[model samples]
Target: MPSAPGTGKGGGPDHGYPPVGRLLPVGGGVVHALTTGSGPDVVLLHGASGNLRDFTFDLVGRLARDFRVTAFDRPGLGHSDPLHADGESPAEQAAVLDAAAGMLGLGRAVIVGHSFGGSVAMAWALEHPERVAAVVTLAGATMPWPGDLGPWYRIASTTFGAATVVPLVSGWLPDSYARNSVASIFAPQQPPDGYLEHVGIPLTLRRAAVLRSNVRQVAGLKPHVAAMARRYPGLSIPVEIVHGTADTIVPAAVHAHPMSRLLPNARLTKLPGIGHMPHHVAPDATLAAIRSAAVRAGLN
Candidate 1:
């Protein structure tokens, strides 16, 4: 197999990545990104354990008709290089992606983030308010939550896990478990058809760099939000947030509702009985939110 551009966690060729997407040079390492569409730019940030393909599966195609949709693989996941070992915060990822967007020639576009990507999107808008035309967070985790991310993440976040557990799973993790894990995120809402193949499950699973970075990001999310959440009120740009009531992963009540209350210029749309994967389960609703924000910010 051909070598992927970015270095893997163990300092080896990123064979896990296929020869798709562009390798964008930014910061100290390169980030992988894909662009589509023909109008105003819309920057897409995928959640943890995801790549640009998540949007490419459906959302990118839908939005490409009206907007320039650019999707990025979060650093260390998919084909992007891992940030510095200490760089686990949303702010860190946001910085890298922001630089990439500028390099890719995306200017003053609507920033859309889903799940953990929401956190990064919030950071991006906060840190670079001048660059963001508007913000759309889909079931994003912007508020602090109680408890840890269960056993898998708990273990993956540890020093021992990084050295031992991560490599074990990366090398031998079964396809069944990986498939089910992806499906579980959608829960009551099935992952539609052919999501797994389009999503590049093995790339996400087999990359130790991504595994360590994701779990560490999750482990440190609460405090990270605590530091960043206070900055929401400072944002004067239009912000649209959509979250599902049935989302067990990042409940609307736990994140979106309260966060909406905090933003000075933001509105939250509550999707009743919808699960965590709102972008997949409720694309129309998600699209509507993006359109609304674009209109409010006059990006159209």
Candidate 2:
């Protein structure tokens, strides 16, 4: 792997953001993980178009105060290699992360996932039940939504888009555009100071592989979640769900509400007037959810 040039307007290798953790070889490629603190194990999986830095920005430090935390850059994003070109499903991502967790000696842990990571968390618990003590989702897209995704998703997942539009958009799209996109995700609640810099926006958008993986994963998420939803009742482990009422990106009514009803031991926290990034906007609620999960899981 090469270094990113810098987190400037344009994207290139060595975007000046070096890995803050070790790159462990997993299977054919490597998985980048930043581990810290001490106590019961807590594995954090970030959303699409993001890396482990999202947790390291604020949430990880808070959680680390009481529990051992490992934040992974999901395959095909950040420094982690893509599992395959066709796009790795949430189950595939979960399997790879589980392997990486085993290599790191992580035993049964409270798996926390945000957005796309939430789906991966579900997959993780479903596929490797013995390793998961509990589960937590922050505005997770757990169930399939009614309608199709936007035009960008439809176009970007195609062969033409992957070869042409992906590279063009990754290289030419200005930093302002990307910043605005980030801001929109956290609408109704502004992004915290220095979040754009800390989250590695340039690396997220500039890399064609990252874009392709994200596009395909998101485009194909509905069917996967639909399948996962059927098995929710089989999961008896405690689950804590945190979602913002105002989060249009992954609406609570669509995912969290139904999920709570499905899971036998599930608690839902709905933050009024909050948007998609509930973990950042409402850290208190997010922290509370994690603590609740830990206590319930007997890990505290």
Candidate 3:
């Protein structure tokens, strides 16, 4: 278990963004979950360096109008406790979050994941098919890419970086630089107004644990996805893959395109001129994909 909120101790960073819903103690660590609306279950997982707030910013509110939406802060990202000092594998993350969902008494759910969260969603469906009604990946990083993730990720995941560099960067990183980084992620298409404040960039930048965990997870993601991809053909559940043609982070050519072909039952929706944040860039399309997944899974 970790320390309480706002303590800034063994727990996550105290960014003053309190939990909007409840916290669940499962697998010996706490997970933060925001549940809303009422209907068939919908579990949302955000991408790397993001908390549940990513969905709560807009998508979850709209989805809540029709479905019972539960947006969770994946282990170590937000209010949730880190599974371990080393970056947690997607399967490890899925295991802890699934336990949290079970504690909430949620039945089979339409699992929706964004960016890195998409990998976690796939892992969840792979590990606990009985608990997942379907899956939706919004600009998800589902497949292994061909190149490295750059020097930042490479260094951040190292022992020396985690012990010294992470703390140093966290201590002195300027807000402007962080904002610029966010902008770069949404390049070609600017981020929506107030996304930075709403999503809590400080929470991610200021927390050494969060930064270290994120880098480790990202650094180790390619191999994980490669192994996971080998089993995609065996996954028979409905999968709605919503990707952007313009996504540079997880290029559609590298991931979504090949993944659509591999999955036995998958519908790919390619949004033209959209970026990595498809959920935010094109919420209507994202919502439609989720709804489609629900219908295909016999939930609607």
Candidates' RMSD to native:
2.3, 2.8, 1.4
In candidate 1, stretches whose alpha carbon ends up further than 4 angstroms from where it belongs are 1-19
Using lDDT as the measure, what is the rank order of every candidate, best first? 2, 3, 1
lDDT, candidate 2, 1-300, per-residue tens: 322323211123746676788677776777888899999999999998888899999999999999999999898888887777777899999999999999889999999999999999999999999899999999999998998998999999999999999989988999889888999999988999999988888667877777888888899888999999999999999999999999999999999999999999999999999999988989999999988999999998
Candidate 3 weakest lDDT stretch, 10 residues = 1-10
lDDT of 3 by residue, 1-300 (tens): 534674422255477787777877777778888899999999999999899999988998899899999999888787887888878889999999898998888999999999999999999999989899899998888898887988998888999999999999988999999889899888769999999999988777888888888888889888899999999999999999999998888889998999999999999999999989988889899989999999999988
Best by TM-score: 3
On a 0 to 1 TM-score scale, where does candidate 2 land against the true structure? 0.96
Model 1, residue 296: distance off in Å is: 0.6
Per-residue lDDT over 1-300 for candidate 1, one digit per residue giving the tens place of the 0 to 100 score: 213454534234445446367777676677888988899889998998888888888999999999998999887677777787644688888888888888888889899999999998999998887778999999898999877678987777779988899889888988999888987899888888989887877676777777777777777788989888888888889999999999989989889988998898998899989988888989999999988888998888
**Candidate 2's C-alpha lDDT?**
0.88
Count of clashes in candidate 3: 0
Worst 10 residues of 1 by lDDT: 1-10
